[model samples]
Structure formats: C-alpha cells, structure tokens
Target: MRWLPVLPAETGEEFSREGQPGDAPAGEGLLSEGACDEHSVRADVEAAAGAGIDRRVYFEVFGCQMNKLDAELMLGVLNENGYQLTDHPSSAGVILYNTCAIREQAENRFFSKLGHLKKLKGERPDLVIGVLGCGAQNHQHDIFRRYPHVGIVCGPGEFLRLPQLIDEARSQGQVAALDLDTPVRFERKENLGPRPRHAFVSVMRGCDMACTYCVVPRTRGPEVSRPVNEIIEEATVLAASGVKEITLLGQTVNSYGKRLAPGRRIGLQHVLYGLNQIDGLERIHFITSHPRFMNPDLIEAIGSLEKVCEYLHLPVQSGSDTVLRRMLRSYTMDHYRKVIDQCREQVPGIALATDLIVGFCGETDEEFAETVKLVEEVRFNGAYIFKYSERPGTSAAADLQDDVPEEVKRERNQVLLGIQKRISLEANSESIGQETEVLVESLSKKDKTRWSGRNRKHQIVVFPSQGDEDLVGDLVTVKVTEVTPVVLVGERPGKGS
Candidate 1:
C-alpha cells in the first residue's frame, strides 16, 4: 500500500457537518466530492477536553469534502458544549442534520430523508431536531416552515451557538442561525473520537465565485480563509495523534487568500508548503482548484513534495468558452490547457481528473462537440460528466433558459461518458506491467481476501495480501497485472508471477 504518515494517536471524531468545508452553504455542496490506528487514537478526546457538555449527539452528512470536515469539527463543538452522541435518531435529545445542495437530485434526496424524520418527531414530541450546514443556510425557514418537526436551523458558522439554539428551539420549534457571516478561523475543537490515520483540516470557508449557475456566494457568503498558524497547529495536533494523511479543504482552494488583503493572507500553496513540515505527516492533498487560481508555485509544490499525491481534480465544467463565459468560470479553454500542461510537466505520471457538464442550459451540439474535442485532447484519468440540473435561486436559474431537451441532454451525456470510458481505459492501461506504490485503505467490498488501496495518482488498486499479515496501512510496491474502467488489479512485488 502507499504511505499515510502514521499519526501518534487521538480520540474519536464525527465525519462532517452540512455546512460545506468550502465557503458554500449546505444545500449547494453536491457539486464536489480514516480510521486510523483505531483505539490507539481513542475517539472523543476533543469532547473530553473542551466545554464539558455531554448530551447525546448524532450527524447525517450530505455533499462533499467540505461537509465531511465540517462534521468532524462539529463533533468537537458539540462535545465541548456538553452534548453526548447517539446513533439512533429516536433516542437523541437534539438531532442535528447537516445538509447539502449541489444538484437538483441531491436536494430531492435531502427532502426525502427529511420526510422520514417527520414521523420520528410524532412518536417523541420532545425529541428536538435541528437542520444545519448547507440546507439550513440555503432554505433556512423553509425547512422549519415545511416541516414543523425540524426545530432548529443553523448554517456552518452558527454551529458554536447550537447549545443555546437547542434551548431556544424547545419553545418555538425553530431556531435559525449561521456562522457564515463572521470572520472565520475559530479555535479547533478537541478530538471527539479515535484518531484515524487520515484527517480533513479546513483552511477556508465560502466562495466569491459568482458562477452564473451557482448558489455558493448567496448561501455561503464570501471567501474567508483560516489564519495560517491555526491551520498549522490543527494539522500538527492531527499528526501527533496519528493522522497519516491530511486533506486541506476549501471551496476553491487555489483562490485562498485572494479575498483577504495583504499581510493578512497566505495562499493555498503556502499552506501546502507549511503543512509539509509537520512531523508524522506522510502525505498532503488539497481540492477544488479553479483554473483562474492555478499558479505556478502550486504546480511546482505538487511535483516537489514527495508527500503530496500526484492527483489533480481540476474542473473544466464545459469546453466551450461561450458556455464558460455564460457560466462565469473566469478562465478559457486555452488557459486550462496551459495549466494542464504545467501540471503534467511538474508532476510526473500525474493523474488528471476533472468535472464536466454534458448538457447545460442552452448548450448546443456544436458546443458539446467542442467539449468532446477537449476531452480527447486532455485524455483525463477520470471525468465526472454530469447533466445540468437547475437549482432554484442560482444566477443561471434566473437569467438562463433551460433549453436543452431531456432526451437530448441524456444523449449528450452518454456520448461524453463514452468518450470518458475510452480515455479511462487508455489512461488505466498505461499502468499495466508497471509497478506503483500503493496505500492500503480497506479490504475489498466484494472479496475480503483482497485489499483495496490507491496509488499516488489516486487510482484504486486491489491486490491480494500475499499472506503477509502485516499488509494493512503499510506502503508496498505492486505491479499492475490487469485493468478495469474504474480499478487497477495488481500483484505484490516478489509475489508469484
């Protein structure tokens, strides 16, 4: 398996809160996308260290990395405030639901889940439920008005006030709050659960990207990065507690610090460089870099930092500049090409992944062909090709017409996916018969005899343990013997041919 920089040890922690780790609100987070030395890192240490409130708390996360990291910190906040955690929603004193709103479909699912909770409240009238994260921020009173059972609503920034909100929720059955409006960089909460070998450290919150089709700016407020010192300290603590990998999260990570004036800022590249120095940190990674923010220094850091993985998930939502202009992406196709060229030059064997929308509002066949051409040229390792789904309150929803027919959109999506399948097959085939360093993550879901991990390029690798009981969490070299569209099959070095 690849390396995860084994951490010292810590207590347990939650997965993420609904408010995005990015600057976006909860409902607007779907657009993106641990265990550790379990027990050795005991869970909930952060709770024991802070405020001392110990009521039962639970979290249900939706959306992407930002939300997950929010959930992680929320646990510390709840524990410090004296809220204990319980897995069952029926038994909890106060139920917290972290929400996401990236696409129409994910939002639809959010409501469906909310419907399930309505019946629970009927059974136990005192069982208070609060909606937090993106959903609370995006549709604040709607959740409360639509479902009276949802007693409290708060955005990510408002999580600190949850204890008081719960008390207030008891009387009105609705408490609306959000932490998004203030200057960010609050104190890091203590560990709430056992430390995993990996962790998510949020560096920034919100977005200023007025992308025509996005709700981030409206729901999440504006871009605000955490001070560098706080980030470094939190990461150091994670390293000391046995976190082997740390993923720095933000809305558009590359744009970090641009919103803040000079002397008060350190960019994402600087953060990556800073975190590289932390003891026990074996690997570092960051996400959602905008094309406009892809700087040379960040490119060079990726190539130079051995601990940094060679995987870049750059989103080129559409290939046509006309469509991009309408979408307010702020970078052209040629500019993206230059960034990709720089990435390949800097990080050898870099896995290039991206996001693409197949059928956006008013997208033409010709424009889509341009996107196809772009895909052929880039030959991405993987592409999240999606059909445009309108989101209420977004700029595009107000200004643009939903012109593409559903079937035509579907056809275009299939064509793009076909192109991606070809590219993915070719990209994966290149690794065959070649040896790659892998980090074992988990046992295969389909077969326990096999182990599942990923390479530095972020490609999934599944291989047999080869009877070396000492296989999990260790870095080992393996030769790619087979390939699939999504996974790479390999055999350990020195194992039978």
Candidate 2:
C-alpha cells in the first residue's frame, strides 16, 4: 500500500508524447567512467575491504519502482564495499535522494525532502547530501544552481562510483553528474538484502523516444541496452540469492538491444532465452513498453517461456490514430489491435494493462469516442488514464497547440475511466471462485488480517490470513471469493504451485 507518485498530468506532459524513432546518439560515452578518480576501484576495493566503514547507512528512496530497485542496487554496491544501511536520514552520514525527473511534481517533492536534509546538515555540517538517478540526470546543472548545499549529483550511471563519489563529496563538497552515456552498469552488482521471491533487474538505461509528452530521452539520454551476457550473469546471481521473480527494467523495455549493434544486435528475445536457461528463476515480467517496438520475437519469448508471467503493459497513449498521429506514436490502431491479437494467440488468457491519455491538443469528441471504442474492443484489465499538459521546451510546446479545454479534458477522462471501470470489473468477475498463485508482498494496511499480492496477470489479490502467522515475501495461493473493479478479495486456499 505504499504510495507511488503518479505525478499529476500537468507535471508529466512531455513524457507521454511521441518522439523520433531509431534515433540514438552514437559515441564513446558508453562505459567511459571508471570506479575511482586519482585512484582505482581495485585499490579502493582493497582499502574499502580493510576499512571499518559503517555497514548500516540510512537510505531514502523517491519516485518509481525502478528508483526503488536502484536504491536496492545502490545498497548492494555499498554493502559489497563494506557499508551498512540505516533507516534514519538524520543519523546517517550519507543522505542520498534517489531521484526522479519524469515529472515536475516529483522534482518538487524531492526538493521538499531535500529541504529536510539541509536542515539536518545545519545541525551536522559534515553530512553528505548526494542526489542520484533520473532527476539528477535531468536537472543536474539546475539542481546545483538552486541548492548549493547539494554535495553530489550522480546520474543513474554513477552508482559504481559510490565509494569514490562519497569520498569526494565528503572532502570537496561537490561531485559532477556522470555525463549521459557513461556506462556504469551495476549489472554485476550484488543484492544486499535477503533473497526475496521478487526482484527487479534493470536491463537498459535512457530512452530515445521524444514522445512529445515525455522527458525520458533527454533525462536519461539515448537508448542503451545492457549486454545480454551481463543480464544473464546478474540473473544467475539473483537465482543463487533466491530471487524467484524478476522484472526487467527500462523506459521502453521491448526496445532492448535495438541500439547495440543495430541490425546485427541481439534483442529481448536473445535476452529472454538467456534468462530461461538460468536455474531457480520462477516468473519474469517487464513493463512500460512502447507499442511500436514490441516485436514478434519478444512476443514469442513471452509465449515460449513458462517462467515469464502472463501479463503485459503496453502503453497505447491514445487509441485514436489521429490522436496517436498527433502524439507521433508512429503506430496505428489497426497495428496495435494486431499486436493484441498476436499476443492473445501466443499467450492464451494473458491479461493486458495500458497507459492511456484522454485529452490531447486538437482532440475532438469523435476522437475521444474513438479512444473509448478502442478501449472497449481491447477489454483491458487495467488502464491508467491521463490528460494532456504543455511542457516547457518540447516539440509539442513549440509547434502544436493545446486547444482542448480543461473542463472538456476532465469530462473525457471521466468517460474513459468509467468505461475502463466496467471492463476491469468484468475482467475481475471472470476470475471469481478461481484459485491462483500469488507472491505475497505484505499485509494490507487497511486490515492487517488481510494479506495481499499479485497474480501472474498482475491482478492485485487480497486474502484473509487465517492467522497462520505468515510473513511477507512468501508465495501463497488464494481463491478469489469476491471481486471489485480493482481488487480481488480472497482467502488462503493452499500452498503455491
């Protein structure tokens, strides 16, 4: 039940739009940054091994599940280097803001939290306030310009330099953001915590899409997929560590490896084949896919790999081709419907979720109706609906017009959501009285007696615990006794499959 900030549409406008395809900045920024400056990671690894640095460091995480996993990875890197993690931001010597920049609202929230860190620093002047991840990458110069107290601005690629960055930030009061394309794959990075049933493995950094409503290609830089061998190695490590489920992370996950050697590159298919070979891995899932690049081979992998979960989240943005064309989504309604048909054929009973935008510039009532009609045809299990907002310095902001009235946008959003509610309820009703396996995440905060987890289709299931003294991270089976549009209330049926 932890709150994940799905920023208000006004804040995330640019991120939802469309951008140029097959456009990648080819260059040497890949893997250029080393472990340590003036010194090498080998020497620091030795010294860090021998040093008695605190193993317990307090960590603060902000933004998406990807950032949460990055926090996990950063913790892994530090723990491997003999650093401990602490929960309190005030007591810890290192205070890191695991950041996000996909939306202005998130950036504002991070700075609001940073205000607290600065106050803590006022009490202890030597405290290290370091920022990392997408927000750091997106607003590197701007962040420093406003907050001189920030000691370090490390991007998503700079976690490998944690030991070094911490050292310099402690001494010099500043660390440069790792320039975009600096390859610092924590790919082989260890997981410091206990082997959970579910884990996240980031497969790519940055995205090239300029969806007029998105800031990713700029914030995280061009599309860069991790090497397949590296991903398998990491998956093997996770397998050894007891991770049963893995979700491949990326802005456009299906577009994995398209940038790596161009036409000769091994894509997500090769990557999936490698993962299916790993021992002890149970279920796999990936997300935030662009409908344009999720190729047939990747679809085949989802069908062929039993360990791969039976859920797919391909964000359609808008169902109307006119709206999509304006958004520059590049794919047509017929094309998306075809992909849906193809996927349903391959993975029978696979549940589908999507990100939807209701109101965009020049959208008419007919266009809106087209979106609603398409949603009904797709019968999506879930859909995240959004309205458009003008972002600063984007193509949409420059060339296009934001002609839709706010009231009209709200009405369209409500109509779309109203339709989705019925579809989701129907979808959930279809599962009533059926038993399914779920990965138990935690007890529902609303009622501690009810445990919650997601099924293979990514449907949220809440079941009565029966006072069996269960803990989080255990896989269990529950029978769907009742349902809502979004939640499935059930009871423990037996052990997992």
Candidate 3:
C-alpha cells in the first residue's frame, strides 16, 4: 500500500515541455531556483537521519500494477536515501499518496483521503505531504492550489527527483516536479519492505495508442521500452534474491522493444527466452496486452517458454465496431476473436482474462448486447468489467457527449458481470479432478490452516498445508476438488479423494 518517489537528476534549471528553461510559477516557488542538486538533497536527508529526525514515510499507492512497481522502485530509492516506511501516517514525518487519474472512483477516493489528512497536517505542521503518479502529472500545480497543505507534487516520470523534491519542499514553501519528457527507468538496487516470493518487473513504461476515454498516454507519456540486457539483469537479480514469479509491468507490455535498434530489437518474445534461462525463476507473466500487439512470436513464446505462465489479460474495451472506432482501439471484434483463437490454438487450456468498459460516450444497448455475446463466446477465465467514467483532458471528454445514462451504464455493467460469473464458474468446475501446479504464496486469509497459491494458468488454488513443512515458494501439485467463480479449492495430489 505504501509507495516512494524518484530521485531528481542534478539540474539547477527547470525545463518546460519545449525543453527550454521556464520560469517558476509566482506563488508555487517550484523547488526553489537552483535547488535541484541531487547531492545536496542526499546530504540533507542523511543529516536528518543522523540527527534522529523521523524519516518515516507513510506512502499509500492507488492505481494499477505499473503504479505498484513505481511505488516499489521509489521505496527502494527512499530506503537508500535514509528513509524508513511506516504504515501509520500519523507517526510518520512524511505522507505520500501515489494517485491514479484513470477512473473517477479512484480520483474521488484519493481526494476524500486527502481531505481527511487536512486535520493531520494541521496537527503536525512539518508533515511533508506529497502527491505522485498520474494525478500529479495531470493536475500538477493545480493540486497545490486546491490542497494548500501539499508540499510536493511529482509526476510518474520525475520520480527520480523525489528525494530532492521532499528535501526542497521541507526547506522551501512548495515544490512541483512535473516532467513527462524524460523516460522513467525501472532499476533499483535494493528491495523495499518484505522480500516476497513474487515481484513485478516493469519492462516498459507509457503507451503510444491513443484510446479516446483513457488517460495513460497523457499521464505516462510515450511508450519507452527498457533494453533487453537491462530487463534480464533486473530479473536475474530478483531470481537470485528468492523471487519465484515476476509479472512484467507495462502499459502495453506486448509492444516492448519496438523502438530499440534492429540488432537489439528482440521484442517481448526474446525477453521471455532470456528470463526462462534464469535459475531460480519458476514462472513468468506479463499483463494488460494490446490485441494489436499480440503477434505470433509472443504467442509462440507463451506456448514454448518453460517459465512463462499460460495466462493473458487482454482488454477488449467494447464489442461493437462502432464503439471501438470511437474509442480509437484500432482492432475490431473479429480481430480480437482471431487473437483469442490463435492464443488458444498455440497454448491449449491457457486461462484468458480481459477488461471491459460497459458504457462509453454513446454506447447503445445493441452494442452492450454484443459485448455480452463476446463474453459468452470467449468464456474468459476472468474479466474486469467497469462502467465508463469520463476522464478530463481525454478526447472522449472533450469531443463526445457522455450520453449514456448512469442507470443504463450500471445495468449493462451488471449484465456483463453476470455472464462472466457463470462462465468462470463453469471453467473452474471443469478443472475439478485435474492436477495443476501451484506456487504457494501465503497462508489463506480466511482460513489459517490452509495455504493459497496460483497455478500456471493464474487460477487461485487453495490447499491444506502439511503444517510440518513450509510451502511458501515451492511448487506443489494440487488436485482440484471444489470451486467457486473466483477461487479453486484443492488439496495435495495423493491426499485429495
């Protein structure tokens, strides 16, 4: 839940979108002139640590897996710079909220939380409050004006300047580090918080596709893929440190290595091949793929690779071609079906998941019915169904009318959820009596006696632990016995009747 920010690059002058020196806003002071020294910021933080000041930071992250990885990396940097993470915001010297601007619900939740923090800030005047990620990038200086208690506002790209921004915000009145021009790197030497059995490795950042209702391209900037060598090295380090599974994080993960040189342009398939060679890694996964980029090579890699799990989370926002055109999703229903058909053909029994936005600008009931029909035909393992919420600055919000009534949107959302629920239940029922491999993650939250893990298909399988042995990272064979729409109840192979 806690997150960290990036260290600022050593640059005395701030640059505008045009890459020219820009004047700081009058009231906002924007990190003070010439205060972007990374070394000085580190020294100040180190001195603060030496002085026994509370370097505890309470970080609450909102949004997707990419944001989670961002938080992890920033936490590593903060940890390196003499900051400690605390769960309790009141006890911490700093409180940071890594926000999401994608959904209206997420934004509302953040503002509500920020409102609650006003009393806390009033009590502790020195409590350095910061906002990071998409919301920070989208709102920027406006956040400071609205929430005067906020000392720092950093975008996703400018995380490298986090430590420096925090230091500057403490010394100066207010500081803003909103720069989306620079490519955000995902390398960190140290691991923050607990060293879990699984981790997320961000292979790429941002998105090139301009979906009308989405805010990723605006919030995260353009797509930038990390070098193959760098990704392999990061995964290697993670495997060596006891990580068994790693989900490659990106906006559109399948489009990795598109911008790299011809010699180094190996794409995501090659990245999988490299990770498959790592000694300790048990499983590999990537998420939120684009249907357009689900090429044959990537599909072959998923089928062929030993470590790569057989699961795909491809989001088909809508089923209607007209809606798809308006949404600017590029691919049509037929193309999406073809992609799914190819995936199933290549990797038999591959569990498939997707994202669905029920109501968009001018979605019709007939279009909604087509989505329901697609769900019935595909029968995905799971689907993240959401009602469309207009995002400001997006093309849909600017150009199109949010004509779909809220009641209609809600009805359509429930309809899809119902269909997917039945499909999921049926799929899980089919798995009963079959043996599957599960990487034990932790003890079940509801039942202390049982252990929980995910199979290669990314299905949640729970089995009773042989209390004598620890199975946190071990791959155990489980015989599926019972199932629900969302979970699978299984037991150790021979033990299950």
Per-model TM-score, in order, reads 0.86, 0.83, 0.88
Q: What is the Cα-based lDDT of residue 203 in candidate 3? A: 85
Ordered from best to worst TM-score, the candidate numbers read 3, 1, 2
133-202: candidate 1 lDDT, tens digit per residue: 8768888758877888888888877776777888888877677887677654444644332225556777
**Distance (Å) between predicted and true CA of 122, model 2?**
3.0
Report clashes for each candidate as comma-separated counts. Answer: 63, 24, 8
Give the top-scoring candidate (lDDT).
Answer: 3
Per-model C-alpha RMSD: 6.5, 8.4, 10.3
TM-score of 1: 0.86
Candidate 3 stretches greater than 4 Å from native: 1-53, 193-195, 262-265, 495-497
In angstroms, what RMSD does candidate 3 have relative to the true structure?
A: 10.3
Give the alpha carbon lDDT tens digit for every residue of 362-388 in model 3. 899888888888889988877666677
Per-residue lDDT, model 2, residue 287, is 59
Off by over 4 Å in 1: 1-54, 185-195, 259-265, 466-471, 495-497
1-497: candidate 2 lDDT, tens digit per residue: 11122111112111122111112110000111100001001001112233233333555555554666666677667766777554455446676777755444445666877776666777777777788886787677777787877888998777667878888888897887667767756564455332246667888877777777665566667778888888899899988877777878777788888757767967887878888888888778885577888778889899989888888877787778888888877899999999999999999998887777766889899988888888889998776665666554556778799888989988887788688788888888988989988777666646666776677887777777665676566777788988877777777765321
Which model scores highest in TM-score?
A: 3
